[model samples]
Target chain A: MQLFFQHLINALQWGSFYALIALGYSMVYGILMLFNFAHGDIFMVGAYIGFGVATALAALAALSALALPNWVILVLTILIAMYLTSFVGMLVERIGYRPLREAPRASAAITGLMIGIILETGNLAILGAQRIRFPSLIKTQVYDIGGVVVTNKKIMIVVVSLVLMLALNEFIKRTRWGMAMRAMAFDYVVIPLMGVPLNTIASLTFALGSALAAAAGILFAVAYPVLDPYIGITYGWKAFVAAILGGRGSVKGACLAGFLLGFIEIFVGAYLSSSLRDLIAYSIILLILVFRPHGFFGEPHSAKLRL
Target chain B: MRKGLLLVVAILVVGLALSPCAWAKSKTIKVGINAPITGDIPKVGEGSKYAAEMWLEDIKAAGGLQVGGEKYMVEIIVEDNESKPESAAKAATKLITEDEVLAIVGPQASSQAIPAGEMANNYGTPMISPWSTNPDTTKDRPFVFRGCFLDPFQGPVVANFIKDEFGFKKAAVLYDIASDYPKGLAEVFKEAWENINGPGSVVAFESFTTKDADFSSQLTNIISSGAQFLFTPQYYNEVALIVQQAQELGFKGPIVGSDSWGSAETVKLCGEACYGLFFSTHYAAAGATGATKEFIERYEKKYGYTPDDVGALTWDALRLVQKAIEDTGKLTGNLKNDRVAVKDALAKIKEFDGITGKMTFTPEGDPIKCAVVVRISEKGEFEFYKSACP
Candidate 1:
């Protein structure tokens, strides 16, 4: 029972991060009937930005010889990171997504791939192909949630993710632009017809989603604390899988899928042999795709990638 | 007049460029270095090339390489493999068949080195891998020999350190399964650790991908599992991230790793977060004795940065190969005899005081080098601790 509870804790903690990432993926997919192949990279960008800003601030403090307090430095660095990452996300949408909006689906998908490569290669060139560790907002501490061990980091991850998610949910549901976004999701032709301001909405969606990813990236650093150029690629792909598994276009589904995916992974790794864990988890995902092709919670896709 | 001058200058530049390979007589024996010039692991490839270049310069300046009855200059032909396995194999094929190299020096990563090893083995050409620590790269391959210890040896080096030095009862393990390196290291570490401390002491064993952005989940469970120490055998990139996350998850206990942590990138990436983390590596620049000072000085003069363990190993590999060629005095002869002579010479060699340590190869083709334990200082630099080969 203790082992089971421990595994459950493991699942919940991991699931939160996965859900946060998947939320970014699902939101982008929802707003633009396009899969931002680079969303995962956007997450990476956020984390690297966090790492860079923190390091630079730390260096500056060293130069002045002030030796700033850890928390003040950390918070200032994270805010800078969030702003920079959101800007990058907006830029990606502008340069990468804008040109191909009206082009052939193949071209748009190719452009998305190119964008993915561009983000990775750009990161490689700028960051020099090394992983940079991001400083946590605070030091880690452990606590118990119902006799199951939970760290302060995990609690922060869970709380922050929930807050951002709720905020995003509120923004979409309560706002006028949010209604238009839903209308656009229903039909793009009706967007301009309804004077919904399509471009602004798209940009806002990218910004919001990007910022969310940035926050998630920060929390992830706080939770895990390493930033690599290619990290986004793996997490992005997994988050995409989560998004699809939970019905890619649905915000709730994406979040649910993320948590579920995390739970499955941790539980399997805990129960089954670690070696078999990856193969089994991925195999189960494949089986789900085989059986329901539309994912467990994913809606009947108008257009989606199964490959 | 302008056109004629331009043509003449172009011709002169071309001639100058071609002089190295074109003006070379058949008397010079060429060694090929296939390097990972691009990609995430470029530093490893770059280090190998830089070290090889330095060694080449030292050997050439010393009046080339001595062949039988005459001295022949050692010519090194470097090809960029771009860090791809296929590219490495292609480079090997091109170097052997087209460039007609007497022997090859590199193809760094084990995944790349294996196929390159196969290419050399097929042609019976000697190839010295500088830092490909995966055991399979040399196992059963007649021509493939390494200048570094295999992952199995290196991994257990740290695992035993964790068990014996720290006296840890249990360890939480995390390793990237995608790499033959980390995969192999993680396995060997488990075997060695459990052998010493018994099984079930490892409470949490988790695997991650090379591209995993978040390892906190794994670390969380590890933190809760009551494991006394953390064991990770990961590349510099992953190690940086792992250490940061590990530290964030409140893991202050000694974290032990393999030689894969022998990178400045690990320090740069982890920064102050990596303080006190320990790893077993081939070389650390403390208490320099024997060839260590000489290597560090020469390398610093050339590269302007401190040489890491991999760099030291590659330099040693180059020197060892050159020594074999010079001793045999048959390196400049027909490719067959030179190859045979170098291979035979490498096998018969007993001892060399290398920067890493006193080294010799076992008949089974593993480097008999000491693996040293190094601790990451508070300022994020590696300080040497101790070494054990016994």
Candidate 2:
């Protein structure tokens, strides 16, 4: 029972991570009809941004020779990092992906590879190769529930993910621009007919998705306080798989698929050899994609402006 | 005024061109140190550069690598590998083909040194790896060598350390299967451990990608396996998260690791819960021998930080190459022949006092160095425990 509970909590934390990033992927794919390969790199940017800000704050605190309040520094770092990295996301779209939006799919993929390399290269130049230690945002106080010492941050992660997701759903359903976005995704030719500016919608869409990625990045660093440039590549790929599995255009399906992926990965690694974890996870994605040409949540022939 | 500016530019350009000679005339012989100054393993790679730079300065102060009847000055050339395998290959190529260096040291991790090894082998340039411990790195490469012990030696040492320190009868192992160093070390430790503790001592031997973030499932299974010891011969980030999550899962047993655990950042990321964990490494700051003490004093005076295993191995590697160069007694002519001579001289090295210990290479061209044990403190520092090597 104890082992079962621990594994379940483990699944929940991992699932929360999937869900957080999957929302951005699904939303961006829904709006842009573009496979945003740079999304993961943007997430990495978010983590680094958070690390830089936090390190600075920590340094200042150290210089003062007095312990600063942990919560204040933590919240400030996450928010500042999210804002800065969101701008980076905005810049990525403008510099990397936007110019290639009208180009060939292969061109965009190549651009994505370049962006990934650039972000990683920039990290190499800036942070040096070693993983920088991040200060924990949440206290590591585990609350015992059914013999599982559930970490406070994990609970925060699940709660925060739900809150952000609900908020996103509300924004999409309640706002006028959300309706315009939905219409645009259905057909951009009719978008100008509906008096919706495509460029404005596109930027807004990237901004929203990037903001969410920033949040996930900060949360991820909280649970695992080691920041590196390449860390986001794996998560980005996994979350992308999750988005596609749930149906790339469908937010609800994305969340469901992400949770499903998390469950499968955790259970397999726990029950089977952890060495084979990646192989199993990727194989599952392949199987699903092979059968379901349209992702579990995404529609077939989903087309939108890529960049 | 235009002619005056042009003439001024000409004189300045000529002066700048001849300045290398001017600098060289100051009695400094350039000791080219090429490593991943930027990119994924920069901590380890930069440590290599730092150690080399510090050692070169000391050697220059103490009459640099004394070649046959002459004392040459030392200058360090640091390069960036950017963490890509091809980039590492390029760096080695540039350092050898273009730079025509006397000796080269680094491109730190095993994933990197493989390409660097071949590059050095082709050019007959003697290159030393500070911490790239995969035995295959130096397996067939005559000119490539290392100063620290390889993963095979480290594996048994860590296994024994855990078995004795934690009184662990059984252990669970997890590492990247793709990495030669991690897999080789895990295999050796598994055999040595099972031999002593009997069969079925390994409860859950799992594998994962080095790039993975969620290792909870593996840690949970290890905890459930009733294993007293946990071994993760993985990279620092994954190991930190594994340690953090392992403690969170309520398994407070001693976790053992390889030399990759030498970084202070790894321990800080793992936090307070990972205290008391032991790892096998090359150098511990405590119990310094006279030579090591001098090296430490010189390094601290130069770089302003205490030397870790990476730093120590780098110092030794550079010194080994310099020793080989001195034995060759040739400065410029027939450079290829000089390179081969250096390679031969490097192999002839036996029981030289290194920063870690007396280091020598086997016939396979792999360095034989003593492995030391260090335990993590509650304050997140590595405390020297004991040494374990033949």
Candidate 3:
């Protein structure tokens, strides 16, 4: 039982990265009715941007000119990286997606995939093939509670992820931009009739999603501290699955499903043979999706109608 | 009409610019390097390339390889396999057919080397794998050869090291199911451990796929199972993550690994978390002498980091190929006969002195070599521990 709790703690932290990135996929899918397949590469780009900004700040601090602590520099790195990466997300949507808006959905999906390849290869070309090590921002302190061991970084990751999700929930509930997004999801033609520009909502959605992915990227760096060009490929795909399982256009569903997927993967690997973890975990998820095709919080409506 | 004429002229110019292979002389021996140059393990590829280049430079300085009193300069052509098995086969085929090289050097990983070795066998070209240790890499292929010992051999080396040095019977294993090297090494180690320490001595056995980054669940089980030590034979990237995660789970026992953990990047990636871990490797830089020491200093000067076992094995493979080419008496300028001669010569190599150490090939083309065990000190350096010979 104690071992179960220990794994649960790990599952929570692991799920936070998925939940954070999945929100980007769910939101972009919800608002624009287009899956940002490049979102995973965007997450990768965000992590690299985080690495760059964090490295610069750490170097500056090492100069002893700023007299700033590591934690303060880390906070600044996360905020700045998110802001810069949001523009990248917007640029991708603008140049890549906007050109194919009137084209077939397959074209947009293909464009997203192409953009993903470009980002990955571009990073490889620019940075060379060497893997970059993310500088440690916060000192790890292990907190022993009964038999379960938890690190300060793990707690911080979980808490920060929840806080970001809550903030996003509040923004979507209370802001006019959130209202515009909701209207766009329901009917794009109707949203323009309400005097809100369609392009503005699309860009805003991409921006928001990219920012969340940036947060997840920075948090992942905090835990793993090893940054490679291709780290986002598998991570992005798994989060996309979480986004779908949570239900289309449902933020709450994405969060819940992300954690659920993490729990399933962890428990399966722990209780059963780890070799069978993905086989059984993904199979269970497939059964759930088979019964509920629209997903847990998805509406029984066509995606075209939502667009 | 003018645009069309200009386009035709441009095509002619470009075609002329690219057809230099048609005018190449056959005086020099053409060697193909089939390494993974651009994908997941580019560092491994880069190391192999540099090692080959370093040997070529030294060979040129010594007035090239003498065959029947005729000296032939070596020319190396590198092809990127993109780190995939099919890509490796395609690269090897292209090297044999298009480039028409005499002998080839790599396809470093077992997954690539196994398929590429088969292709070399089909083409009747002698190919030596620098770092691939899986038994299947050269099992049935007479034309194929390897520089490193088989995974089965290293498995007992690690198991016996832990038993004799650490004296730990109870152990845990976590491996990558999708990877050929890690999976093969893990199975061999488990069998050896059980045979030496008794059956059911392994308390926990877990696995993850190639795409997995989180290993906390498996670590939790291993910790809770009360195993005295852990064995993970995955690549350096995965090993770095596993070590960090293992430490966070409060498992303080010694961690044992394979040659895959012998890279300098493991320390850079994992920081202090990988300190004090032990692994069986090809060569250790500490306490080295003669050619091994010289190779280490030159490699460290050329590349920023110290040479790992992969780099050393690649150097060994290059020297072995050069020696085989010279031992065949002459190139003869006949591709088919020369390739056959090289293959036969490589088979007859009774002994080879390499930077990795002395090695001799078995009838099956696998090397009978000594495996060195190294430990990561508290300062995060690979310290020489001991050597295990078969």
TM-score of chain B of each: 0.89, 0.87, 0.94
DockQ of each model against the real complex?
0.26, 0.55, 0.72
Candidate 3 residue-wise lDDT, B1-390, digit = tens:
999999999998898678976456467788999997877677788888988889889989988778888888778999999878899999999999988899999999988998999999999999999899999989889999999999999999999999999889898999988878888999999999999989999998888987577899889989988999999998777887898888877888988999988777888888888888899999998789999999999988987778878888999998888888888887788889999999999999989999899988789988899999999999999999999999
User: Which residue pairs come into collision in candidate 3?
Assistant: none
Docking class of 3: medium
Candidate 2 stretches with Cα past 4 Å from truth are: A1-5, A52-84, A94-116, A301-307, B1-34, B62-65, B70-75, B83-86, B330-332, B366-369
**Backbone clash tally for model 1?**
3
lDDT per model, in order? 0.76, 0.77, 0.89
Q: Order the numbered candidates by TM-score, best leading.
A: 3, 2, 1
Total backbone clashes of candidate 2, pairs 3 or more residues apart or in separate chains: 14
DockQ of prediction 3: 0.72
Would you give me the overall lDDT of model 3? Answer: 0.89
**What pairs collide in candidate 1?**
A224-B245, A247-A298, B68-B329
Which ten residues in a row are the worst by lDDT in model 3 chain A?
Answer: A298-307
By the lDDT metric, which is better: model 1 or model 3?
A: 3
Candidate 2 at residue B22, lDDT? 35
Tens-digit lDDT track of model 2 for B1-390: 999999999999998788664334334444556676655556666677778767766786887667777777676778778756788889888877766676678877887788888888888888887778888788888888887787777877877777776677878987877766678788888888887789888887877766677778877777778888788887666778888877777776777888888875566567776687778888887667788888878777877766778888887788777778887775554557767788888888876877688866688877676888888877677888988876
- Candidate 1 per-residue C-alpha lDDT over B1-390 given as tens digits, one digit per residue, 9 for 90 to 100: 999999999999998778776556477788899887665576777787888888888877878766566777777889988766778889999998878787888877777888888888888888888878889888898788888878777767777777677778887889877667777777887888788888887787788765555565577667778889888877777777677666655666877787878877777666676778888888887557667888888887878877887788888788788777767855444678778888888777788767777887788666777778898888777788878785
